[model samples]
Target: MTLLTVTGLTKSYAGADGELPVLAGIDLDIHEGEIVALLGKSGSGKSTLLRCLAGLIPPSSGTITYRGRPFKGANPGTTMVFQTFALLPWLTVQQNVEVGLETRGLPAAARREAALTAIDLIGLDGFESAYPKELSGGMRQRVGFARALVVEPDILLMDEPFSALDVLTAENLRGELLELWDSGTFPTKAIVVVTHNIEEAVLMADRVIVLGGRPYGSIRAAYDIPLTRPRDRDVPEFSKLIDTIYRTMTGRADTPHPPHGLRQPAKRTPANTPLPAASVDGLSGLAEILQRHDGHLDFAELTDELSLEVDDLLPLTDALELLGFAAVKGSQITLTDQGLAYSAADVQTSKQIFATAAIEVPLVHFITTSLRNSVDGSLRAGFFRDVLAHHYTSEQVTQQLDAATGWGRYAELYTYDTRHEEYHLDTVPS
Candidate 1:
């Protein structure tokens, strides 16, 4: 009972100077009543595949068949919910939901009935007449869902629809969607959700598809979600699964940045001048400085205090600085107050991003947030290491976290005493 089948799908677009392929030789089958998770990085053609399957974009050379027939462009049997809620502001909730039915040119009474049913199904029973402006982020997203469902599509295509909602609201909607899907009362024979969240994929998808490779996205791996429905996150198996998906998605078995005891050379700045504030350009020199110093060193000792080379820092320093989490001045390159704030925010933001990816289990994002908020010292390091340990060594976590926080001061305080092979967090004496 295959609801949709896409074969020989390929897509390419002209770039600034030449044609670039986004998807190549992708073949996928979505079965009846099954949820399929499509996982990939930002530009990895996950969305392109979804758009092609939904007929939003025509493939360069491919055929998309819906229920054993060639899918005509934007047919009623298929509906899509975009990451951005596509509700018409001028329209009331009821009107927005009804738009799906209007395309069918159904009679007025039939359209109204279908719209009301969708509204109820999505838990908007009392607010049928409210406008998009009158709803919360979650409710607005529900309107998008209701609209998609009203058409009674055989297959539903969702492109990270919950990515925008708050966590509580997203979780609620997820529950609702699952309830409806489990009840088997709606016409939805299958669903295809595209996400960057590995946990989201594992939780909802019966089968998880990882789009890997370069030039054109290829299937890196396809895993079956064997966990029982409504799985617990605290379980060991769950954590293991999360770790596995994360490694696959990032295209590495272990963590990308490992901590070496080597400290970067310090970036020199004025003794009293507050660092000009950290930017992505200076993060690498700052990192190398910290490594050279073996952790914490005063700004005056840095070799390149006045002028620092910036090109050597790629992805690492760039990501840290561009995100506004570190800074440098004449004698001292230190973490700006904002940098500290970002470290805290990054923990939660990363969690949210990971949660949206649709993986059943949560790993990196989960551990980062977990350690940031915990009160116990060893628990902080232990739990932190527990999650990060699989992909990175304790030293690596310490180094990356150190660079990220511009907490070279903290890094020096805590170093692994290999004699005991235990991490010791040193509290600086005021």
Candidate 2:
């Protein structure tokens, strides 16, 4: 049975120039007896979709139905577990767990009983009387779980619930949750989790839905997990699935099963090819690592060796790709000749190489050309920000400018005066 159905969902927020779309034409269904993981990088609208399902935010357009009924406000059949734990600092664990019940008008005694039961089930029975400050990160998250579960809604929504915890703690919590789920004592009929961690999604979800970032947030692909519970990460099938997901997320066009959504434009622009939030040092460090590995490295092995999540590493790789320094095919990242030279060159030579390569990046090119054309070899930052405002939200404009500023400064293409908010052409020779 389908617990939730979303059709042609579109969500947008007010931006400087106009409405900025966050999610577009999202079509999804949350069925009973399945854990669906919404996986995507930052800005993919995973959390936005989850909030839409929870009815915390209204969609700009489209329909959401719960058990065949139109969803109007707070979803009666859903409760959310947040990444931040969101517990009242002054409240005891039991009181925090009972919050939803209190709002639902359950009698005090009954709420207490239910909260205790949930606390016990989530391995926090002894912590019920303790304040949130008295608990560790894992235990606080357990309280968050208990609080959400105490409501016993038909659908449970989690927004990066494990992201705030340490690796061992998160692993342990995931195991405990799965054990409870397998024991058939878990209250919810369905679970929807938002995450950027690909492995976490593969490990915990019965179905994984990948969301794309470019153009807007929309489902790129959905895969059903056939592996049984307690999946082995070391197995070949697991590794293969992870690799496939990596390829999909990285937008490998030749990937066997192409995702169903907007393809990145053949012509790159500042709007479409926004600079990845990576620094010069970060991308250069990765290139040096690739140089050490003979100009190529399997994506998975590099991620493991660096002990970084896919989200953490992707920005660096994206930056390298944007700068024409690297290429990613399937699960392999190969450093290009430009990348090799940049990695091997001395400081001054490397900056020159980077400047030449960075100019190919649309935003960087735009900034450099605009500065060069200026009568005084300078322009106010507001001029560029206003030009970009048409294509991005205010926050996005800031990020774009910041990225461009960093690259321009490092390449000596331009120098930004923090106080004056201006960009000046670098007169010094490389």
Candidate 3:
């Protein structure tokens, strides 16, 4: 049975220029007896979708029905577990767990009994009287779980619940939760988790939904997990699924192909193809590694060797691809001839190559050209920010500018004066 139904959901936030769309034309259903994971890169609207389902924020357009009834306000049938372990610092664990019950107007004695039961269920029985400050990170998160579970809602919504915890602690908590879930003693009938960790999603979700696109707020694909309970990460099927998800996330339909020993410059505008948040050093390091590996490596193996999550590596890979220094095709990244030379070249030689490549990037090109066109070969930083504001949020505009600044400085294309808030074309020959 479907516990929650969402159709044609669209959410937008008021921005400086106009309304910025987040989730667009999203259709989803949360069924009973299932754990659904919403997986995506940052800004993919995973948390926004969760908030819409929880009725914490109203969708700009769409219908959300809980058990066939449209949500009028906050959905009483769902409770949230936050990443930050949002426990009241002054409140004892017991009081924190009782908060939802108190709001529901349950009698004090009944609320206390329910809170204790939840605390015991989550393995925090002894910590009930302790304050959040007295507990470790894991212990505090356990309290967060108990607090959410004490409400006994039909569905539990988790927003990166394990992201802030230590790896071992997160693994232990995940195992305990799964054990409880398998035992059929879990308080919620359905679980919805929003996470960027592909392995974590594969481990816990019965179904995984991938979200992507500009602003990364649209559903791109979905897969049903067929693995049985107590999954083993070492299994071939597990690794295969991870690879498939990686390809999906990085795959671009319009990826350019080099021809005649020259890289094809992207025709996209800066707004459409925003620079990936990666540093010159990071992408350069990855290129050197690829060169050492004979210009190719399995994506998953590379991630394992670096001890980095997929999210950590994606930005670097994206930057490499954007600069025409590397190519990714279905779980394998191969360094191009240019990439090999860039890795082997001396600092000055590499800068010349990078400068040529960077100009092909729309944002970098826009900056260089704008500075060159100016009468004094200089322009205020606000000019670029104002141009980008139509397409990105204020925070996003800052990030884009930062990425461009790093690339421009490394390529000797332009220089930004922090004190004067200006960009000068002193390095580039007119």
Candidate 4:
């Protein structure tokens, strides 16, 4: 039976320029006995789509249906496990689990029964009175899971539920979740998990759906994970599946090498291109790794070697590409001479190299130019923020401005007074 259906799921927000579209033309159906994993880059609206599904946020346009009824504000049959455990430190595990049930007006005895069952089911049977701060991160997230599961929803929404956990803890939690799902005893008819970890998606999901590329998120591709449960990652098929998904996210591999000294010129990005947030130090570290491997690293090979998801590694690579430190084509990431030089340079020289490349990014250039032309050689950061409001969401503009501020200071292009939230020219062009 179809448990959930979404169609033409267009979402947008008011911006200075016009409506800034988020999810566009989204169509998806989750059926009984299915676990659908949504995978994507950082800003691809994976979380937004989940919020829309939960009816926590109204979409600008589109429809969500749960069991043939139009979904609206906090669907009665749905619950969410947030990435952050979202547990109240003051509430004990049992209390936390019963919070939702109590709100639904379940009698105290019934709520206690449900919470006890959920805590036991999630393997936290003895921690009923332990508060969030008393439990470890993994233990706290177990309470998050129990809280969601205790409600006995028809569908459970998980937003990168395990991404915040340490590796071992995440793996343990994923195993337990799969066991409960596959056991056929869990109350939820279906589950939708949002994650950035490619392997985690493949590990726990029956169907993997990727949301990628453009910020106006749409389903890029969906793959049925052919392997059976309790899957082995070392198997050739598993590795191949990871490679296929990576290539799908990156849009194919196997490009010929660029010229000896220079990388391919960057494609023009949007004026509000949410500039890469990976740090200069991180990008240089990746560059040095690629340099040692002959200035090229295969996509799948790097993931296996570094044990990093594409989401975790892509930002570093993107920063490298943006700064002319590397060129990524398909599965191959090859460093340019500039990248090689940066890797080999001392701290001061590396800063100059980064600055030379960073000054060309539109946002950085805007800040530099704005400060240079200021009458008093200074301006409030809010000025650029106002300009960016035309291009990005308030949250996105904040992140962009923060990145630009860090990169600008590192490049010696300008100085940011955090106390005043102001920008000042390092050297006024008189």
Candidate 5:
């Protein structure tokens, strides 16, 4: 039943000071005909673990066995789908799907048929000839998926394949994928997904694997996603599961305030305390930590507070530095006043954390900033789609926003407004 088993897997990279370990003493077992979801913060080694499982990178120490044999490297039947669509620009959809089949060396006619079947299976019946540029974000991702499917891999590896997609498109694709899996088509015997979305994991995966910080991608916890097939997010059980997972990841207490069952007011800290000029700009780890806690937070007390081991905290802390919330002054972490304000601001107590308008601040700020500074008016449409689709990297998002807002480069991209369900532009910079 164990299709893939990894034991004591360790990986490291050379750093300025020493060998920086990225993954350490990791252990995992994936069964046949199951989907395993890997959850973590952005740089929590989810991608590295996925690469290791796919044999894209060899671990420094450990044994990986697939179906009881050593997993030395990528096999003919193992396929991966990356967050970026990674399609050939010049190739049509059909051609891109067929590209994987080149190694099979089947006759042209046979290959064409196989490619067509894959395209259809992924719901791209009429899009076979469209180029990557012409296809929408969702459609292009499907083409990447079709490419993976054509190879008939035993295990499919997905590194946030839907993360770049807009919510509606991503939801639609998730539904279609589940239907395909249910129907026993598409060729993958098992699947493993690396994702930051807990709801997606709960809905799609049979098992959820939580990866904790860097120096080693260690398992913080593994929970069986007990919801039945065709789960509905509107249901109470579904909401409960999401809430639990969120609490587990961020070391937050279950139900910060008593009995807010489904809906609760957003928590905003009183503007007291001297607000320090941010050591750096942008959302910090404090934001992530506070979001995990549903906005009721304690600084200094919560750092290194995760259930995951000490080795798993470094990269997370390092990333916090980029967000301007985490600073190391001689082995001590000091949270800037901005970090505290952002973390303690109007966050709703709803079970659906992501569904709240407060959740839209960062995203809206990101989008608005881009639109304000764009040189070409036409690029706005594509750029908007990219944000909705979730295709671009954080760097890409910031770059576009910076480019769009050429006037005031230091505009505060987000703010809390109770009347608006999402962050509204405080004032369009004149």
Candidate 6:
């Protein structure tokens, strides 16, 4: 049965100057008896869409319907589990689970039974009275699950819930949830989970939807996970799916930044673009790893070895390419002479060589030139902000500036004073 339907969904935020569209022309549907995983990088609209589905926020344009009725507020019989445990510290596990019941004016006796049942279902029966602070991270999350399940929600929305847990714990929790879900012990009709982990998405969901790049994104692709429950991650098909997503998300290594997905603006990350957060050290580390395999490591091999998602891997590679250290083509990474050299260089030599390449970036050059020409060799960082605002969204501009700042700071091309938001020439020689 169709549980929820979204049509022509568009959402925007009012920026200082105008409406900044986060999601546009998005249409989606959720059905009964399926777990849907929303996957994307940091800026993608997965969370925003989740919020919209939960009715926590209204879409700027579009309609979301629940059971064929227009959804105006929080969807009935729905609850959310957050990435953070979000358990009230003062409330014991049972009390925490009972809070929702209390809000519904359920009698004390009924609330206790419902909360206890949920607690036992979530394996927290023994910890019924344990405070959140006294519990391990995993147990605290179990309390979060118990609290949500106590309401017997029709649809459960999970926002990176397992991201905060340790690897083993998360795996264990996943196993437990699947076991209960498959055995008819858990009763939720449907679920939506937001995650960055590719393996996790493929392992748990009936469908995996890519939210794509932002400040513009929505339902770029939906992949069906046809594998059976308790899918083997080491199986060829599973491993192939992981690599396919990596390539799809990151694009051909030879392709420039923002290589694939929703947007197709430019071949390279233009000077005005906000580079995703990455570092010279990270670039070197990837380069070193690639070099160890003779600079011909395929995308799948590299990601498996490093355990990096497309979002985590692509930006770092973009930074390296932007700085002339590497070249990416298809699924392979080839180190430039500079990349190999940087990998082998002593600390000082690496930074010095990097300084020369870093200055070649247009934004970095602009900062250095502007600071060099200033009366006191300084310029307000806001001045750079003005330049970026014209080219990108306000939030993206901030990210761009951060990337620019990190590059400048490392190269000693300029110094940034966070307290004053000023970019001044570094007095220390490079």
Best prediction by TM-score = 4
Residue pairs of candidate 4 with colliding backbone atoms: none
In model 6, the runs with Cα more than 4 Å from the true position are: 16-18, 252-277, 288-296, 304-312, 321-329, 334-408, 413-425, 428-430
Model 2 worst lDDT window (10 residues) = 255-264
Better of 3 and 4 by lDDT: 3
Better of 3 and 5 by lDDT: 3
CA lDDT, every prediction? 0.61, 0.87, 0.87, 0.82, 0.64, 0.79
The 10-residue segment of model 6 with minimum total lDDT is 253-262
Best of the two (2, 6) by TM-score: 2
TM-score of each prediction: 0.61, 0.79, 0.78, 0.85, 0.64, 0.78
Candidate 5 overall lDDT versus native: 0.64
Q: Which portions of model 5 miss their true places by more than 4 Å?
A: 252-430
Residue-level lDDT tens digits of model 2 in 104-146: 8999999989999999999996777899999999999999999
TM-score of 1: 0.61
Candidate 1 ranges beyond 4 A from true positions: 252-430
lDDT of 4 by residue, 151-245 (tens): 88989999989888999998898899899888988879999999887888888888999886354677888999989998999999898888888
| Clashes per model (N, Cα, C within 3 A) | 40, 0, 0, 0, 16, 6
- Residue range 72-129, candidate 1, lDDT tens digits: 6764467899877988999999999888678778888998999898888888999999
Displacement of the residue 59 alpha carbon in candidate 3, Å: 2.3
Of 1 and 4, the candidate ahead on TM-score is: 4
CA lDDT of 313 in candidate 6?
A: 83
In the range 1-430, model 5's lDDT, one tens digit per residue, is: 8888889887665432344455677889988889999998654678888888888889877888888888567844469998999999999999899887887788889889999989888989999888999989999999999999887888999999998999899999989999999888758899999888777888999999987652234677788887878889899988777766655665422222211121121321111011112212223343556556643333324533755432234334443443454454433445555455555545432112222322233433344555456542113334443443242335544443333232112234333333432333435555
